[model samples]
Target: MFTPEVPFLRSSATPIPGRYVLVFDSAEQTESTSIGLRARAEEVPQILESEGYSLTEYFPRLGIAVVSSAAEQLDEFQARCASRRMPTRVVPEMVYHALSAVPTPQPTDSFEDTDQATWGLQAVGAVNSEYTGAGIKVAVLDTGFDLAHPDFTGRTVVSKSFVEGEDAQDGHGHGTHCIGTACGPRTLADGRGYGVASGSDIYAGKVLGSDGSGSDATILAGIDWALENECQVISMSLGADVQQVHPPYVTAGRRALELGSLIIAAAGNNAQRSQGNPGFVGAPANSPYVMAVGALDNTLSIADFSARTLPGRGGQVDTSGPGVAIYSSWPGAEKYNTISGTSMATPHVAGIAALLAEATGFRARELWAELVQEAKRLELFSVDVGSGLTQAPPPAEA
Candidate 1:
């Protein structure tokens, strides 16, 4: 309860004004050691209301809350907590943006969409896999999806919008592109296959809004919902460029793992290796309990904009995927588009996770281990690419 000042490194992530995230210590942390901690957790909302703070959202399962209050009230609450063992921490709510990098011109020799499959499908060996992730549930949390897009016709797409007053529809196009990569059709009308886990159930959570930005509250809500539905794999193609490990995601991820769900997130697009800038991985990908994904070009080299690993725990890239000039679905009459980023790389890994789940019957931490063990090790530094580029289980392995 005595809220300590949360130290943060130099970060490019934006903070939402006057909003703070409250993280309660888990039962195991406080129940045996401290008295009345259980009651404190249950009475947090009423206690905050009495202290002049408005509780915006309370996630009981995650032991977290979002609140709006004056600076003086927060200060007073901290003072009161300092006198008593409060077992809660407060940090400023941060805004996370979709991690799509600026589109670079596709190289003339780069792998292209063919009559059979996309270059990403080839890179991950998904095109050759026998498993189609038929019974697996994959959740993609982003800026909604283009539900009306023809590519999703006759597919089981369960969608919901966490962004208030908005429907689960792709307004920014990033989510649709991601969904296309992770769970689109096995074959398009033109006979080209772009998706990896084409037969998996689609759970699209509109965490980010049409503008491609969402606060921690919205994103956490999406995670909670996905966990509630018992999604086997959750894909998040978004992140904030903060160097510190966000505490809330640590709790959410650990609990998700305990529940047999794995959360995969973009490592962040803050680096420009071409300019000698090797950026660090950011939250929530940087959380040890979550998986952080990097981006690779068609030649199997690291992308210039993909973030590198930081010096501490939860800061390393867990794996990588095809992310440059990749072709996938889009909104409206355009129907499809090609883009790049760790954002795009994320779904490639997620789709592969689905295939692996379908192939090996693994979930949570075991699924994470399977992905790293099966990856095609690259010549790149482990700091930049971790275990290596993610690969699908071949027909023999499947």
Candidate 2:
């Protein structure tokens, strides 16, 4: 009876069938309304099954369900929900990819200074911070991680793979690099550090596959898992190159913040601003509730491929980080490599968020605001770098 109008777009048509997430009012509403809503949700699986749609999973707390169906079925489903005033929404299942690795570098010990390998760590003052993110929990959702990577030998990591039959192992290398930057060891075997919040608990959720691609459903499931684990920080280095916000992600982000978890995403790597063509921020990250991060080079310049914020676009780049030719752990026996993208920039912020979480006990929006406040203000427009490059939190006063 208390159906609020949900803002979600309808799909026309596509060859392959995809998953759609239907959202209803929270199950924590008034008792009568909550009961009614739960009843309606319980009826959903049967209703969809009757209509030839398969229900994938349901989150009773958030009042959301994922179903695999065709566009035509989705249109009919939307109409039915509207008729009943269910206040439901259909989330698009678009393909999103890892934003970096334009040119893969071979693993080498050429860089004598380990700190020199990861310029991002130094850029964010990771060297000075005494806090190693100990006791803090961080979730990095991307390609599977390398379970046998030597650098992570003694670390405590919990991993799960959401990609149908795949295991949570980094065959693509992107997730391993991201984990290395966000929660890798304080000091590598060679004595040079390349991570922030090095001692934080690592949660690796493999949403993307070895091909470095995944759909919205896979990614959303990963978000659900991260929030369920009560991770203080969720780092997403993958996203669809779309200008508009995906409705389910917006809902998921709001729910995560409400539950004291912060989701950070890559702005995207599809821009050519200097060439008179600028790309807009990508989805999930483009959603207002999620923090959208861009890429900055060693010279403090925006990366040519980093997406930009534009007028009328719902999402804007929130902050920046060192993404150009940054070094970190790689998959296989190689051990390490350097790559670039807004994807690379994202983990820098996540690692820093972990440190801030450890220092201030701030959760959700407060944690987000704290990161923005301490960022090093650069002589650049807010659209390029919302509050400039992110900085590590300073030492607490006695």
The stretch of ten residues in a row with the least summed lDDT in candidate 2 is 1-10
- Model 1 residue 341 CA deviation (Å) reads 0.4
lDDT (CA) for every model shown?
0.85, 0.78
Query: Evaluated with lDDT, which candidate comes out highest?
Result: 1
Per-candidate count of clashing residue pairs (backbone under 3 Å): 2, 5
Q: Please write out the lDDT profile of model 1 over residues 242-328, one tens digit for every residue.
A: 899988887778778877899999998888787799888999899988999999988778888889999988999999999887889
Query: TM-score for each prediction?
Result: 0.90, 0.86
Candidate 1 residue pairs that clash:
1-86, 1-87
Output the lDDT of residue 367, model 2. 98
Scored by TM-score, the top model is 1
Residue 345 displacement in candidate 2 (angstroms): 0.4
Q: What would the per-residue lDDT of candidate 2 be over residues 278-326, giving only the tens digit for each residue?
A: 5778787887779999888777777777778866545888888888787
